[model samples]
Target: MKTKLICALTGVGLLLFTGCTNLAEKVLDEASVSGLTDKQAADGNIAPVYARLPDIFQHTTYFALQEISTDEAILPYRGGTDWGDNGIYLALHQHTSTSTDPNIRNTWLLLLQGISRSITAINTLPTINDPASKVYIAEARGMRAYYNMVMLDLFGIAFLKDDPQATSDILRGEAAANYIKAEMLAVEPDLLTTVGPGRLSKGALWGLLARLHLNYAVYRDRYADTFTHKPEDMDKVVEYCDKLINSGQYQLSKDYFPIFNSDNHSNPELIFAVDQRAELNGHNRLAYFSLSGDQFPIPAYVGANGTDGPAITPDFYQSWVSAYAGKDPTVDPRFYKQNLSIYSNPGDSCVAESAFNINRGILRGQQYGLIRVNGAFVKCPDGKYKVGKLFNTTRNKPTLPVNFTEKIDFTVAGSDYSTGYRVEKYEFSKKSVSGRNLGDADIVIVRLADIYLMRAEAKLRKSNDAAAALADVNTVRASRTVTTPPPALTSMNLDLLFRERGFEFYWEMLRRTDMIRFGKYEGTWTEKTNTDKQKRIFPIPQTAIDGASNLPGYLVQNPGY
Candidate 1:
């Protein structure tokens, strides 16, 4: 029985279920929602804001736009025409995408949906007139500020509406930045001080503020030759970062890989995350998006292997490899060397090693691991198992090995089914839901590691405290590498900072912003050459411009498109 939520604002209420991968589960969720009290309902109302993220961060959405726009990653046309959706990914890589790009349109709509949902929750959650509901109200407002910030970052404008019936107000450039900063500050006091990864809290607020202030110069002057980084704004970033860090509530995880694993929510590292569990409308795109069809990690849940979409660029992989010119790449803590014992010694089955072994961080080089056969491991003649070639699903033959190496082209017969490095940043979800592709790992929007880096950057840029900045970087490195931490820099500089950030937080929807702030957005990277400053902010999707009846004259496109 399909049931629709009816309210005075029927359309607005219905949007809560938008992009739901599973209808049966979503209907059941809505069914149970009726039993909750007004306060409970209000508290639960902000969930839609979180639900809208996977659509934004999915394999080929905003996250791809962010990473692929730089030297980090790219979505090359597989076998010439498979991923070639009118050359959108190619255009994005070449810095030639226009307003009509599907990703730009989809990302814009999803972000706006987040803003609308937050406003709906803020208006509805306040009805209980109870003091306890204020936290939820604050969370909703914080989320609204967050969604607006992201929209502003991408489109250079943010849409604001206090209530469902109100006219949408457009905040552009610095005005949008200020409004969002003020909103976060306003809600900071009322938010829950306790640690809550998915829900908004004071820690998340501080993290957001630190991020906004650190990038305030760019928001203030996007096209300037030299971005004006106000010391005052930098101080705000420091203040909030300190408050969150000093809280003693959160800490960076010991191992970097686990933080991106399926059960990452349990770690103290995540400050704010989109709760993307199998039970939720989460996606498995992040996990299996790049995996070969034959490399079945979890055979039961994902009957097939992977969709074979995006992959890491040779440039990004080289950045890490080049750094350790002579030394072992695996020793760099960040360069997670996986269970190569399986293929290194033939006839040895690494099926004994968990599926989650090399699934985290950058997957590169001669991939020595198990080959799935008959939905299980391939057995050796001695009854023990043998690692074999991962047959391409299209051919389903044992001809091609699962040896993931950095060699391939943009088109047909040239670019092998596997080209460039693959990253399973989010762990795969084993529990299958019909008509859905949900991953278990909660996609962390903000984590403790980000805070440390933010603080370090602010210190370096604002106060020129290299010692302090280097200290912050060392702390994270020390924790992750128990055997031998990364050698701390004798000095600090922007180039070092850029590489450090790439190492600490690659593939986390942060590369673009980091590149912009460091003025590297215009530099040559892989397929794209250094180009226009306007490319810093994407073109406002033309569809959004066409439907701006509410903000008729207010919705202006970014300079480029």
Candidate 2:
């Protein structure tokens, strides 16, 4: 049975379904809407557009394309068998993905759903005479522009449609960029400023515009030998960034971990985020994705363990070492935060505690957590709990201690369960007691630190002002209030600023575009040695191409595949 939804307009109501990935092209049957109030109509139409976000931003979908494909993260086939998934993940990291790759195809479908849902809301919201519907319509337009921006970034093409059953107008290069920019500009005045980061407020639109302009050079000419950041584009980036910076609505977070905590709804740094409040359509896959199989974060449920997923690449870890002049990267508050108190003493063998606390940041070396015996957690003599060094529970090597190593060889012998250092940035939600599904953390889309970095990059590229760029970089560093926040940099350059961004937003999924903009996408790192420029933008999924085959030249695959 399909889940049907009523897209309530004034008199005519369209029957839509949850499984329709491309709602824009679907011809709907007309149904009469009886007694829906303005609030009910707003809720029915606008909420689905926002609901599509959690699926789009899932770890196996967009995060895989954004983070795992770059040097920031990698998911090797554990024990030469697990996570192989027909080599899809390996293909992505190696720049060998095809149109049939499920991750790529799924990402395309979900992004289209976002655009489709936004289109549904945009077309229906105007019929309501309530003043709030106008704001909802503007938000829908902003969301549509945002989804198109991501589409343009990944596939080098965006589909625009105003009517429900109209054929989408395919756009690319300057035409697509200009269309998205124009839509945002037209809806700017109608967007509200007071709405929280979950919705597209005026500030969030400004942030999106800043992001679109910051990467404007790449979107304009994705395959250039070297991207040229025009002065006007850089100026636009700076102007929009300054609006969010001076708006007095947001601030840099003092403690970096709280910004990703489950209770971070009131965190002051978020400019735009997907609201996972009350575990509404929430997921714990991100928190559980990169953890070791034996290192469970939720103690109450033995089944709530990790699946031995992706880990941080050593090449990315070297960036932090190079930035801090060979000092321990833990000195930088952004790199690590020690929350587990049992490890206060290095030699403490057994602690009688049951709290499920784990340290954050790049988890390397020996890992310690609760031990299980006979399908139950081991308890101390005092009836609390016993902590022991973790071991490989899923793989055949039960005797091997769970010591995460820095060097991963991507071979049968080397790429075991504990090859690369895992990332535990997002806090595991305490609400996930029996399983790793319920999470409440609002995933950040845009924040103030990114704004500052955009402004700094614009300053460097626009006018070669090193001093001004240095000030902006240091402002972000000093805001991390720790025992010693990452010490202020006395100097700054393009390379230094790029490294700074990696430190600040490691698992936040901004690395792929950052690498391309800095002209480092072709550089070799670890298992990836391909220097093909065609791999910059992904190939359009074959399903999408077939879906639009009725209209000639409606959807064309990218140049590579």
Candidate 3:
């Protein structure tokens, strides 16, 4: 009876059943039965589905999920920070029992529901009447599949359903992977053949496929009693990576910064990205997290303290600094720009100024210009300044500078640190300031450099010492800082490749996945030392477990929940 109902509704083009508001109103009206053709219903429904993409790909959720899951980024709240509540989850998954604050849970449910709703709308589109409709549906499905992959990685289960109105069908382990694979395969042929460079193309399908298979070893064992990586799984990864690389559809961008700039949407390197409009979806967090005390002078946002800075983990900074020792300072500009101190300058340009190097301690008014012999504080011709102390004393008693470092701590205040190797992946503007909701940079989800690293890992796994794999990895590293090529490979393994990935793609949300693939997911860090079992998947949202009744056994919660 259920299957019969679905078939009949699909045949009659029950657009309202598919949950497309525009089409439902146009065809059936509020009565749910009115005078309208199936064709009109289908056309009207498609636009609303596209409109949902911006909301579905929202950053409020993705940024939290991405940073918390990786080592490259941490959510250390300083004073006067608004994004602190979510940051606490990033630091520790524990949340207050109060159900009123639903950001995390709401984000999870909305992404799942949004993806499901979008897929339902795409499935309802009338067949092939308009070429544009086909493209739109293809994009929608790809996005749906991508979102599903994220869910599987983070939650270890997906809400599987054939019909739009059906209840959520939870699938775990291999069952989940198989379902995701089937969806990708079903949509592969319909996607655009060549979607320019950065946009989603059939080639991008191969990239996503590579990602799925590369992590198959983990996904397949996420909810199982024991975990093991099969040789065949590695073969599948190599297969998809080869398709993406050999297809000649994409290439690494010459300049790494261009990949993250506001003008980066059309860059050839990006395989897929969530488009962020300045006025609509622009991220103020980057500026909010990275702005130093000087740029955001105190008594403005906070009473005596100024801007709270985002602090990089001490270990992460050491790793980069060690890698670049004795090498040309200009070798990889990204290392310095994305992961170094901001300098103090009185001029307008930030990057062009000399960096402010000071002791890593609290800055007070006495220390402002105490040791300078020339009486002129070493100010950069450019406006860049080291993110240290925020001086907020009035000119009458300017000598008594209050130590505003408390504003940068994670617990007391909500201030996000923009100090100590701040991320410069996206270009920072002089006009942009923290506390002001303004930024116009597009975030990169999948880029060509990532593909090269993926291909390298796959090839190393398949054929240990393959020169082609080594060359592919080296090509990407070479592009950063424009230095001598990396050493030729005599031997290769997942560990070496994973470390390379860590260095190549830090804070881009691939850290946790990379860690899992290399068997480092459960390794201890400053605050977390989760076991392998806990590492595979996050505890099912406590709310979900409490909500389920009928399928108590069917929905066995992941261990350690």
Q: Which candidate is the best by lDDT?
A: 2
lDDT (Cα) of model 1: 0.73
Tens-place lDDT digits, model 2, residues 331-426: 899888776655676545455444557788888888888787667888766776677788886565678999989977578755788898889888
Residue-by-residue lDDT tens digits, candidate 1, 1-561: 245442222232323212322322233255686677776665566566577777777777877788878778777777666677998888887788898998887787678777877887787776665566778778888888998899878878866678576656777879989999989889988988674687788888889999999999999988987787999988988898898889899987877778877788778989988776645765547777777655665533336456667777777787877767787666676766454455465544534434334445677655544455555666555554455455564445467655566754465543566777777666566665421267667787888878888888888898789899888888788887544666665667778888889988888889999999998888886677858998989988776565453444655778877
What overall lDDT goes with each candidate model? 0.73, 0.82, 0.53
Between which residue pairs do clashes occur in model 2?
none
1 or 3, which is superior by TM-score? Answer: 1
* Best prediction by TM-score: 2
Q: Which ten residues in a row have the lowest lDDT in candidate 1?
A: 16-25
The TM-score between candidate 3 and the true structure equals: 0.73
On residues 1-561, what C-alpha lDDT tens digit does candidate 3 reach at each position? 011121112221212112212222222233442343555555555444434434433434555455554555544544335346654444442211122234445445555645655666676664435556676676667666776787788778765665665555677778888888888888888888666533457877777888888878778776445346566766776777777767766677766666666567677777776555443444334433433343332112221112333444445555555655776333444444322233243232232223322222112121221111122223334533324333433222334343333222234432323323444344443234333344455556677787887777767766674677778877776664433444434544666677677666765657766766677655665345555456455555545544453345645666654
Question: Candidate 1 or 3, higher lDDT?
Answer: 1
- How do all models score by TM-score? 0.89, 0.94, 0.73
Which sections of candidate 2 miss by over 4 Å? 1-33, 346-355, 433-435
The local distance difference test score of model 3 is 0.53
